[model samples]
Target chain A: MKIALDTIRHSLEGAIPGVVATCDANGIPNVSYVSQVHYVDSNQVALSFQFFNKTRGNMLANPQLTAYLIDPETAARYRLALLYLRTETDGPLFQNMKAKLAGIASHTGMAGVFELRGADVCRVLDIERVPGAEAPRALPPYNWLTVLRALGQRVAGCGDMAGLFEEVLGGLEEMLDIRHSLLLMWDECGHKLYTVASRGYVHSGIGSEIPLGCGVIGVAAQYQTPIRITHMAAEYSYSKAVRENAGLDPQRLETAIPFPGLAEPHSQMALPLLASGKLLGVLYVESAQDMRFGFEDEDGLSVLAQQIALNLVQLQQAGDVETDTAAVAVGASPAGARLQIRFYPANHSVFIGDDYLIKGVAGAILWRLLHYYVHENRTEFSNRELRLDKHLNLPDIDDNLEARLILLQRRLAEKSSALAIVKTGRGRFRLQVNQPVQLLEHEVGAAL
Target chain B: MIGSSAGIPTPMSTTAPSPPVLRPEDADFIRSGVSVCVASRDVRHVPSLARGLGCAVCDGGRTLRLLLVKSQSEALLRDLEKSGQIAVVFTRPSTHRSLQIKGSDARLETASSGDEQLVQTSFEAFADDLLTIGFSRAFTGLYYQHEKSDLVAVTFTPDDVFLQTPGPNAGARLEPLP
Candidate 1:
């Protein structure tokens, strides 16, 4: 498929996503999609890619690679970069990159990619950068798990739900440099748009309750559609609760609250969080910059919000299902002498602590250890005998068993200061602690 | 791997001794992921023991524990007397050769001697070592009487050590556990 580089560049500049590829010394092939790619120099360019899967594998095998963006619509091709293979570098590539990409980087506010690659023989230096990609979508387009994982960080491991909302809004504000961000919840019981959380807003709790079908949020909730109000005065769905409450100038409603920022809050979007046929919540995103929430942002954030809602449901359900067999006690405080403990409800979410947390196979391994301890009285088990016992309980595949345990170890390391989970000596493992660990507290069934 | 010449079986029974030694051939069997069959016989009625030896090639360490059942229940006492008079032997880890017991050792004929006996004589045999020998379910469940005891069968017990299996150069020795 020989295509003109200028045509591809123009198509990419118009709105075409790029395809990434890399090869090793052995001629092994790897490919992926890149959202952001910029030139470091005429010969080199830097690209940022989410870490995982085939791309990581290729990088490990060989760092030398090439990335290209093709515009089938215009038969244009943009040869992005041909990277140099090196673990160590002190080149002028980074400086050349900051000049070409600093403006977009500042606008997007994403971390700059450090790795650089020289240009291939064919180059289109004067090609305009495409704001969006327009092409035939692949089947099962985005890798769901990876996208979920990337978005999972926004909501996962939140200590307090309400408090995390504020933090999340702040992070989103920082990322987009939006003047204002507010999270509205349509209280199913209350039937009102209660401002549960917000950022860049006044303390008077302005525009608190927008009844169903009353305002932009109300229309969003009623019609189950997003609202992007560029002008509040002309918005028939605009209902100002603060203006109504103050009882001043019903006729001067549009002039009452002079929200210069809201009047021209260039880009705004309201996405409903629907999961399993139920609308749990809605996300309202607005930016001071014009045309900020485009189709890409709308689609991505809507999917992201949907994931959050699904995960929220999972998180709630997870609390009901005991993830860990042994319940460790929490801090002993508040009630003076009363002791408190918390067990990780069995689920994939890793346990959290200052120095230790149970994750993945580590949880499985810990579960097994606890199971054995509960079943039989043992302080230490030899590796030789442990496998025999573990095999009796699980499959005899050692690699599969160990991989899970490693996940648990990493999670534990992240959660707690104690790196003393896996011990080795005399070919046996022993849990060492004089005081009863709060981590092992749980409901004891009739059967041990 | 130095220990007794007695090798252990996989899926060890609860009654089997702990820390059972592994045999050289048993190691090969385990490594090969192969399964083996263990069998018992009554040589008196089935006197084709010599012919059966040829079929024991795939049997690895073919161990034969022959039990001589009494033809007549009453003749068990006389049989026990002779069986008790026979000697026994055992093997060591260091030496691959067999060591036999000395003198007139007697197998107890059902504690006292008033009960009916099933087998007059019982001999233990293995390719490697001799730790202990046990009776088969058929032999143990038989109707028997012991004299001067609560109706028990003639049960013979070895007093001194005896060579359970033949020599080391012929059969593999047991491997020591961790």
Candidate 2:
């Protein structure tokens, strides 16, 4: 069977450097090693225009070129006859190529030298297998379609936002074989993304934030497009982004929260979870091995992201269930250490003693949960009750209530405080306080 | 024949000034475990390329001889026969230091007695270089494999040498050799 150009798109990531050949008008041919042959579409690809060399000169004169690409998986080779189209210095394509080039440059020890001047788009005129080359070996045993089908079913069965979050992360690990992954929520006003859930890390990194356009995850959220990097670049590394942003405003940066990521990741893929043109957040995954996540993984995650966005919107719109008005008798406060909960109204930052817990929606959710537990003596809570609570000012139907609950639970656990929230049943939880709690509200401008 | 050829622009008219000879240091860099590729174009200006097995620089760094697998050189050889012009690139994978040498007069010949050993040594060195960078030996060996009977040599006199390294001076012509 003849393979289409798009079928082998993953092989174009430049793991095995591609050879691009172009001829001058006089017929003298120039061949140069290309770091990447970016797949633009079925019939088009883009090459990085880093230098004004013989290959570039030949393309300008002849407009005809050929590129030899190798399939890293199967070691099969293909020849593409390409016609130079145009050069783009800016926009999504340029940014995508620029980010990818940074990774390649760093991987090859040419960090400062390999800058992308432009993205030279070309029309793939034809694609043919190199005659007499070995046939492509069998692909890996995993079938994406089967995995996607099972994941869709699991996602559909999720009863609430928390369940959905768990299912999504679980499916990525079990169904897709991805171990290290994170789910972050977009903070529109803050201009950052905060981690709500994570897997395969020592710390869950809940509430850790990455500023928009900071790294691979940030770039994906900024453009609302999927960004994949085969080789990790220091320019886009999370640690570097943290250090660079730390000098800025403390309020604007989440410096107190450490971002959880691999110390040295060779491959990373970030996809924006967008619904109806609104950027919800980003789904990120990384691996220590190079080229671990290919186009197939990207496509699979893309489909999952779309479904996740839709479900989130639907659940948010469903709103909270009607509140139960009957007041319940509160049990006497347990005898233990006194826990003081201080709430800063300015940024909605909540602190238990001297340690900062969370801010924003998650913070608001904690404040609300504790408020009910103290005043109403409400030991039990459900998803619907919180959704209907007006004081929380939960964002539209897109509000990730379950994710916030998980964040609250993890944060409380990490602090090992006397106050804890444990799951008793679906969409319901029990607030366990082993000590007497004093709640205090303070103005933002007031001294600590 | 240099500038009077129809349809082909004079190579020296570009911003880059042609070098007089290949520098000794540059020749040594090329002969090292550098990645090599050769290219030529057909009458319609469509280009063809092939991996170069190894290369030898002689005659005081004036003559360059490139070895290629014959089975993979069909299109490249055809282009050479038509135009007698070729451009070859030698890039050190580790450092990304690269050079492009173009020749107006190129000829293809059978591999000589010592050419096989030279190609073998070059391949072994290249494989070792790749190993240090995390590529498995078996993989590198398969990539560099070529039947001795299927090897052919293309010799050319370097006429234009351009710095192809990734940097601000990339594509700039080197100083003219005395």
Candidate 3:
């Protein structure tokens, strides 16, 4: 163990193919080139087990193996002595390796053949640098530690849900120079992920819906793991995935809201925001350049995503407290023609005249607010009361309520309707109705 | 059997050398620009791997000559001494198309006068191919940079050839093109 295995992760990224050596008990050796050597932790690294080949057989019979890792940056080589720990068929490790293998395979013209079945976990038994004159160590583009700390600080300064998301995604652009990204909150009841915040797209797509398990974002959410692809593969493309999904059922309005994504992003990473094993959302980032988000970037963003998830739980729950109901003035509406506020109770869909505004739980919340406004003459409300209400049917504390409110708010702004939900304070907000609204509930067997 | 421990030994084999199974097309591919790696194991089956400078297939496509630097391949050379068994892989970086040839009896000879030109040609081809896939000239230099005086020739008659192009067909026998 002359050197730590953690620092040489660049070599293990499989940017340059790595050589893996294994042997059966007969003293006969088998050598193969592996596409990726996944950095599982400080003591272990995993290789994608794409097929049940001689290497897999040799490993199971005699776990002793050697891996020759060459740094893509420095061309420095190292020999890792690893003991086969176990093969993970499913979990964070397998899913992560599967997604990466898919990207590399497609990039290398091995698209359909490079399918991952499991992750071969190996414990680092020894590590020694192979003494050779290598290319000089090049400086990385920017210090990720500095970027991470600054982003964390920016998120720390945020007091509300909207600002928190903005600071996180905005920090990626301003600090890390990552241009395109989306922050999507998982809708548990609907089994879909809705865009709550986005950056670097022609269309904001604030209310875009992607069902769980369609594309990279959906897969990341489905497995509660990060999915990163270095090259664009049509099978994993969001446009194709959503199109295939809609082809199954074209009548569904879920596909109506176009997903804001690049046509052919070379590199993309979707990191799940996990809080105590519960997935809050997915923070997706992409670039037009190949291998743009390397292993280190994924490591940095995964930590940031977890922190964001925890902060979201705390911030959203903290917003549950009722306060500032009377501090903000509820201004009178301007004289204008009353517009029809159409509601479909079946899916909780709301329509402003003819254009679809929103649906699902967010739609239900908006309708409730409008209902109370029309009947009880109430203008201000708190998130605490919404969470306690049984009618809203909010999922658990994991990525709930506040995110939906943010979605509702963004949708209203996206549509530029007469209605607006303005945050008055930490918890209280006023529903500013610029035009008088007529409530029309459209349900089967109900008076129109 | 973990990497730290050894498993039951399958008694030492005294198998005879078999004829080359490398197809003519694969022979040409191996001789062309490709990332070459040579590997062997100690008596304990603990394998050692080393990068190859370049490669050449000769003797009517039966013999495989791989050039490795003596100074950088001490462990691999030591392992090959005890177990003549060897496995060499050649991969084209741009397409990721690859093949592996295994030899039960491998021999190391001093790099020849004519072998220098053969190795140099492959180096340029491999470097140029890697450049097309975004590898800088300096980075590609790491594989080709070696003193001609230190180059050792590892020669073996291929016993079997396997398609190692990283797909469902990987590790399968390299069938001849129809």
Candidate 4:
């Protein structure tokens, strides 16, 4: 029976390393262990090109070869009669294989020794399963397609950006059973990704930043590809690097919110939230169990990420159109102790009474909100007005006002309980503050 | 071409040593619970491979006799019958310690006296070995299970022995075999 390459994708995820057998020019056969066998498509797969070994020599001489893979879960074996194709040194496939190889190397204690030189593409001429090799097995616990559909519905039911973030993050836990996860939005101008929403952590880690091309999440965002690391490697863990990212500037170090990534996650997966080639950000999930997220989980999460990205795109565009510029500040402000709000335009850092609240775009948005509340005596504002506000310096096309509002709202709720921003209507919000406040704006400084 | 995870992957470090003889430790390691795979190629140069049930080092570590399930190794057995060249890799999962033994002459042989017990012992040992590395013993038992009647041994006098452990020196010849 002809086997489609996708049907057995779990076997190709390198959960159990595969063996590649090739014949040299003299018809002498040689076999070796391969760290990864990446599924390119229905008809092709890419093997990691590590060194110019005899296997490489044989492939150049005899393109026809055999590769044996075993399912990590079932242990069922299959043989792929592959015809060697071209090698890819760059692009999504190469990046994916390279990232996977890094994790394998780190897990195997061969980090620097195991480097991916290229991705050796192979045309799967045939796939034959070892007969009677499989023992009777129980059915899988979950179907990713059904779970993804349910997640999509949960996200679509939300009416606002905060609700959307809440639903998606909540659905990941409730529906897919992904307890530890976070939502990040791309800061295109800053060349970073910031945590907008998170779940299953003691600290929300909101406003935590990771530079592009740094850790798993950063690398995922940089290449716009999904990265799955089954075993925790020190260099790939984002928690420490995120702190470093936060401390890139001395001022940022002082104001950096604690990065809430798992300190020692055994399994980590980061899928880039991309929409039509442009990356929106990244959706990251992690666990303390070895091999928690398999290939199917990655595929499911990628689907969910795309859904969230599309909705986010729609939500951001919708924020631009739904404007009530003449909205009035309602409800009398309560009397309380005076709170001094400091705004640093350099990094858009916001602090109240020496306590840092948030920075980056969210901080800038917070400053703009406090400005109107302090001088203009306004509480209610529209997203459109904020988008149009030139002083905020938000990007013109993908301003991402909704995400910034969500971040600012979450941070304020966590840090400053007395001052909170609540959505009033579509594309509008009311900043509720019980205490009297003083606004102090500072000069621009370098940001991390 | 044969390698596992124990060696560095540097090409310069893989310079071949003199003819390798399997050490007493290699024989002991082979008899322990380690995974095995056998490779052979057809006249057309399309190689074939299959999971090995177990391996037995005979003739004071100079020859290797590998166990394979006949049903799963039809093509490989056919290749071996056509071209007697063979390469077998034995690897311990827990440590990633691996060895590749190659031969120019491979012969098909039926299970001899005590071979069934060897298969069962090797399977349990391999399964037990895998259990230490997080694989459930029961699951690995079923994965490595071999029926007595379905087993066949492919015996070969090894002409080459190489360090197949992954890393830079993976393909380097294992010299001064005992």
TM-score list, all predictions: 0.27, 0.87, 0.90, 0.90
List candidate 3 segments past 4 Å from native.
A243-253, A324-333, A390-399, A445-448, B1-24, B167-169, B172-178
Q: Tell how far residue A166 is off in model 3, in angstroms.
A: 1.6
After the best TM-score superposition of candidate 4, give how far the Cα of residue A79 lies from its true spot, in angstroms: 1.2
Q: Interface root mean square deviation for model 4, in Å? A: 6.4
Please identify which of the two predictions, 2 or 4, would achieve the higher DockQ against the true structure. 2
The per-prediction tally of clashing pairs is 46, 2, 1, 16
Chain B TM-score, candidate 1? Answer: 0.22
**CAPRI verdict (incorrect, acceptable, medium, high) for model 3:** acceptable
Model 1, which residues run further than 4 Å from truth?
Answer: A1-151, A204-207, A229-233, A240-264, A315-448, B1-178
DockQ, 0 to 1 scale, candidate 4: 0.36
Every candidate's chain B TM-score: 0.22, 0.87, 0.86, 0.84
User: Model 2: C-alpha RMSD to truth?
Assistant: 3.9
Q: Which tens-of-lDDT digit does each residue in A262-324 have in candidate 4?
A: 889888899998888899989899998877888888888888888888888888777767746
Model 3 TM-score, all chains together: 0.90
lDDT of 3: 0.82
Residues A1-448, candidate 2, lDDT per residue (tens digit)? 6668887775787777788998776666677888879998888999999887877988888899889887765656688889999999987788788888888888888788788999999999888776433434677658999998999998888766667778999889997778999999887767788898889999889889899888889889988888888787888899887677654456656667789989888888899999999998899999998778877888889999999888877766553543443445568878877789999877778899878998877788888878888888887877777777788777665366766787788888988568888886656777887788889999778664
Candidate 1 CAPRI-style tier: incorrect
Task: Give the worst 10-residue stretch by lDDT in candidate 2 chain B.
Answer: B6-15
Q: RMSD of each candidate?
A: 36.7, 3.9, 4.2, 5.0
